[model samples]
Target chain A: MKHYNIYVTSKPVIYDPAGRASENTLAKLGFSGIERLRIGKFIEMQCADDVSLESIKQMCDQLLANPVLEDFRIEIVD
Target chain B: MSDFRFGIVVFPGTNCEQDVAHAVRWLGHQAEYIWHQDTTVSQFDALVLPGGSSYGNYLRPGALAAASPIIAAISEYAAQGKPVLGISNGFQILTEAGLLPGALQQNASLTHICETLDFYVEKTVCQWLQLASGTMISLPVSHGFGSYYADAATLIQMESNGQIVLRDTQARIAAVCNEQGNVFGMMPHPERACEVLAANHPAGAGGTVFSTIVKHLEVVR
Candidate 1:
């Protein structure tokens, strides 16, 4: 069995309104030097060893994330 | 001419199917509710993906529901050059399903907006919006994620192809149609504004939208 960790986030060119709002709130709360913040989703999945990374990429492309406005990264976990 | 039969798709967490059905019936068309699990959607002449947080907006607003089996049928219906309209969260689903080009992100203000707003019609190629290109109409918008985003190339292409159908006074796009002009996605609830209310005169501007679709269907037939 293999476990994969996925992180999905809005593309950099696309505005992150939620993240900006949170950044504003943090700045107001006296958090200094917070350069940037981008809100995203984290998904963990466990599958059989035979499940290829190509298949996982297909899943992300077709269902897990929208490529038009978001990007995703996958990492295999030990 | 026979009345067009409209199918309102109902996802697990959708809340606006009934409103859409009411609007269709009020507009003198037949209305039916199609469940998300149903595999067949070829029966209806038109399809509507109404507003609401489908799948409780988990993962993304419409991500899960976009993958539902019914979407394939909806795709087939759209491929047949029939009209398919998605309102608000339904718009999100269409974008997520690749039926529409842009993605609806969180509103720029990061606030849930629920108010009646004016949308300037920008394109008339789509049968759903048959009004003059510059006409402004009132429609209610209710959603947290209503901002539209697309890459520069896609936006440029949409502009050149006249795919952008509606925008607010501030020039923020509110609705768009696909290349074939059969699939449409908008972040406004036209269904809520279809009633002739005494409080707001000329309040039912949305009725024109539904009527226009029916007339277009009839003409095509």
Candidate 2:
């Protein structure tokens, strides 16, 4: 089985409200010099060796991630 | 009491199907609950995807539910220009299903905003709302992800196409219709406001929204 990692996040134009609120909370905790914080989803899945990255990408594009609100990246470990 | 039937699609986590059914029945139409797994929606004259954290709202609200079997059936239903209304989470599902343009993101405040606010009905391609243009009505919005997000170009196009249906008092997009105008999606709970027992209903501005749909069906039928 091949393991893959997918990172999904809101497009830059779409503000990550929860991330912004968390950043605010961290600031309240006295953390300083933080540049930015954004919340996103990470998915890990396993497929058969014959499964192609193209299929995985298709899955992400069609269902795993919503193209309208988010962008996703797929990664596989050597 | 009308023979027109409105099917309320209920995803597993959907919690507002009953409210929508009640409102439809109150307006004197037959209301039925159709499960997400159901493959056919042909019998219903109108379709409604009610609110609630469908599929537990995991992987983003309405994501899973949007991919369910019922959405595909309803897509065809909407193509026939049948009236389809999606409220709150239902709106999320519809957008996700590509029945409507734009996506609903988490509220900018990052909390579930539950409040009754005034929304201005816009003259648009929407068939569900028969109220006069610019009419102000009170409706309750309760959602953790109710803020609407669409790129500038798309927003402009929707505005010009008369697809933008309802806006908040501050002019933020609260509801929208497809280019065809048969499908409507909004973040507010009009069912909650269409109470027959409430003093405002039938007389209040937003209270007549459901009745308007009932009337529309009468004409279309």
Candidate 3:
């Protein structure tokens, strides 16, 4: 069995409203000079050892993340 | 009277199918429910993906529903140049399935907003809008994620293709269609706005767009 971790974030062109709201809360909590903040998703899954990176990429493109508004990075768990 | 038949696609988490069917019947049209597991949508004169949080909207508003079997059927239905309307969450599903351009993101305020909004018609090429440019229509918009987002390049292409059909006072995209103009997706709920006599008109502005699409299909088919 293999473990995979996927990180999904909104593309720079897409606005992060949730992230901005969080930043505002942080500022009110006295955290100053915070340049930027973003909110993203992290997903983990178990796959057979035979699954290739290309197959995982296809999954990401097909359903894991929307390519139009979000970008994703995948990591293999050792 | 043109008796058009509409199919309201229903996923497990859908709550608007009954309302949509009622609205269709009110417009003197026939309507039936099409489950997400079903594979065909060709039997109806037109298809409507109604408002609701399909699949609980946990994995993104329309992410799970877009991969359902019926969406594939919808893709084929649209390819044949038939009319398809997606309202509220349906609009998110359409973008997820690649039926329409742009993605519906979280609102700029990062909060859920449920209220009636004024929508302005921009281009008439969608035809189902049946309204001239500069016309305003009021409909109920209810959603937590209703911001329309597209890369600058895609926006330029959509502009060139004449796919933008409607916008709000703030100039946010209220509705859009496919390049071929056969499908439309919007974040407003027309069904919720239908038949409000208290609002002065019996059918209301939302009903106008809803009935217009069915009537338009009736004329062509």
Candidate 4:
């Protein structure tokens, strides 16, 4: 079995409301110097060794992320 | 000349199916619930995807439910230019399924908004909307991720095609239709406003939506 990591984030052009709100809260808590923060999701999965990167890309395109407002990247860990 | 039948697609965690069904029935049409696992939606004259946290809204709101088996049938139904209405979370599912352009992001306020809001009707091309253009109707919006976003080109095209149907008081998009004008998605719970139990009723503006669907079906049939 192989381990894979999936990262999904909103497209840069799309506003991340939750991220913005979190940044404001951080600022209130005296956490400064942080220029920007964008929120996203990370998923770890185990796939059979025979699974191709192409299949993983298909999974990202079809289910893992929405291409319209979000982008996703897949990495094979092991 | 038979009565128009509406199939309300029900996904796991969907709580608004009954509301939608009741609204459809209130409009004098036949309404039925279609499970998410169903493979065929050919029998219904029109379809409605009701609001709720489908698939627990995991990963993203409406993302998982958009990949369910029933969506394929709904897509096929939309291809035939049949009316398909999606409300609140349902709107998210349509965008996730590519049945509609654009995506719904979290509200700018970063809070779950649950209030009766007035939506300005921007266009009447969609099969589900019959009010005169520019009319404002009251509907309840209850969602955290109801902010609508699309690429510039898509937004421009939607505007030119009269697919942008309704906007909130702030001018933010509250509802939109596909270029074909058959598939409609909105963030408001129109179903909730389709009752006359209150004096200052929204006059069941949402019920008018169902009636419009029936009228369109009658014309096309």
Candidate 5:
């Protein structure tokens, strides 16, 4: 079996409502100077060694995530 | 004084019957509760599948509930263009029942979502959403599985055919209508709004959804 490290991140321009709400609350609490905030996800999936990198990429594109709002990177570890 | 007859299907774990029933009744219509075990589609003008875990959220959110006898009758009714509105988990059941297309997966962050989501109208042709294009409505969203997934061709068709009804400002879809456009399944709980009661109206302003359906039925009736 092969192990892959997947890093999923929202688009730079996509608004993170959860983070925005927190930033507002934080500022109201007197914690100022908070610049930018972005939230992403990390996923680790094990696939068969015979699974080509290209096929895994397709899986990530179709079922694993939504490309319109999210972008992902995959790297083979060990 | 027989007004329009409506029915809300109740599965083992559903909890939104009263909300939906209130919406239906408030519109000068009638709503009856239909148990999941019954295959009969009660004499109703429309059917609502409210949100909640059915069958303990096994195999998938709505996988089991879709196979219930009531669901079988719902499918038949939907084929005849009787309105079928599925909210949240009910949406999951519509997909599982094959009444609607696409599958709902876990959130992108793999976390449960419980927040107010803004949904804008994408199709004016839809009976339930006859509002102007770009009308925004606030609705509560509470679920772990609400990510919509479909093949490339189906997605393309949905967009071209006006089946994609409600989307967020950023264009991430929040809801979709079936091919016929009479069957709608959405992740947001519009019935959860405090607008269900006159005293708590502002907080529950989501009653517009029920009102919209009533208007459509009136036009047809």
Candidate 6:
């Protein structure tokens, strides 16, 4: 079996309401030093030796995530 | 009641037919799976197009499914004012079918997103939405092309005409209704959240979609 790592993040301009709300709360508390806030996810999966990277990429493309709101990366390790 | 037959359209790559059907049955309504080859939607109260890569997302998410044999029938049904709903990729198919207006663009980030989104109900005329207040309902959304795109004029018209439903507080539209208001298309899955039997569905409250649709069917009956 092979191991893969996936990292996903939202696009920069899409407006992260969650992050913005957190920032607003922090600013209200006088914690204005936080310049940038972002949220994302990381996923790791193991695949059979015969599974190709292209197929794994397609899986990520089709159902694993929605390409509009999240970006993902796959890293294969020996 | 007895005549309230609902058809769940099946296209190549569609993966949510069973989920939709189970939701329909849970409400004590009749549900059938129809092949993409059927040229006409048979006697039915409503139709549902569930999410998946119909035609392997070829051409466009639903552009090919729109040309499927059963689409003509779906068009006829929509013309007659029967209710129709497309969820996720199903939403794409409706846009491609012209059953609903506005196309689902690639997500703003152009990434595959899977998470429970905070969907606000802007209208109750649609069967899938049950909340009356301006409350945010959290439901899982899994799609690569769920962003909605249309010219500003059309968006304004839809809003003014009450054809837009479920807009986030920031006015980002999450769902839309046809002019006659019988058809609705959204990116979230009420079916997947309908019951606890499915591991992922446990405790998900999106079942209001099925109950509301069944209520509408009762009225039609």
lDDT per residue, candidate 3, B1-221, as tens digits?
Answer: 58888899998888889988988888788999988999978789889998889989977999999999888789998998998999888999999999998888888887799878788987656756855457888877889998888888888988787788889998889889888888999888888778865254335777777667866766786
Estimated TM-score for each candidate: 0.95, 0.95, 0.95, 0.95, 0.70, 0.70
lDDT of 4 by residue, A39-64 (tens): 99999989899998899999999888
lDDT of each: 0.88, 0.85, 0.85, 0.88, 0.78, 0.77
Chain B TM-score of candidate number 6:
0.91
lDDT of 1 at A35: 92
Query: How displaced is residue B114 in candidate 3, in Å?
Result: 0.8
State the lDDT of candidate 1 residue by residue for B1-221, as single tens digits.
85889989999999999888988887778999999999898888899999998999998899999999999989988999999999999999999999999888888887899888888998657778855477889888899999888888999999988899899989999999998888989898888778775245355777767877887888888
Root-mean-square deviation of every model: 1.6, 1.8, 1.7, 1.6, 7.9, 10.7
Per-residue lDDT tens digits of candidate 1, residues A1-78?
A: 999999999888888888999999999999989999999999999999999999999999988888887899999995
- Give one digit per residue, the lDDT tens place, for model 3 in A6-67: 99999886788888999999999999999999999999989898999899999999998999
Deviation (Å) of B111 in candidate 4? 0.6
Best by DockQ: 3
For residues B59-148, what per-residue lDDT tens digits would candidate 5 score against the true structure?
A: 568877877878768988988887889999999888877788887866766579887777788864566676545677877788988888
* CAPRI-style grade of the A/B interface in model 3: high
lDDT of 5 at B46: 82
lDDT of 1: 0.88
Cα lDDT tens digits, model 2, B1-221, are 35688899988989989878877777677899998999999998888899999989988788899889888889998999999999999999999999999899878877789888888888887888845466888888899988888888998999998889889989989999999888999998888887656444343454456667777787888
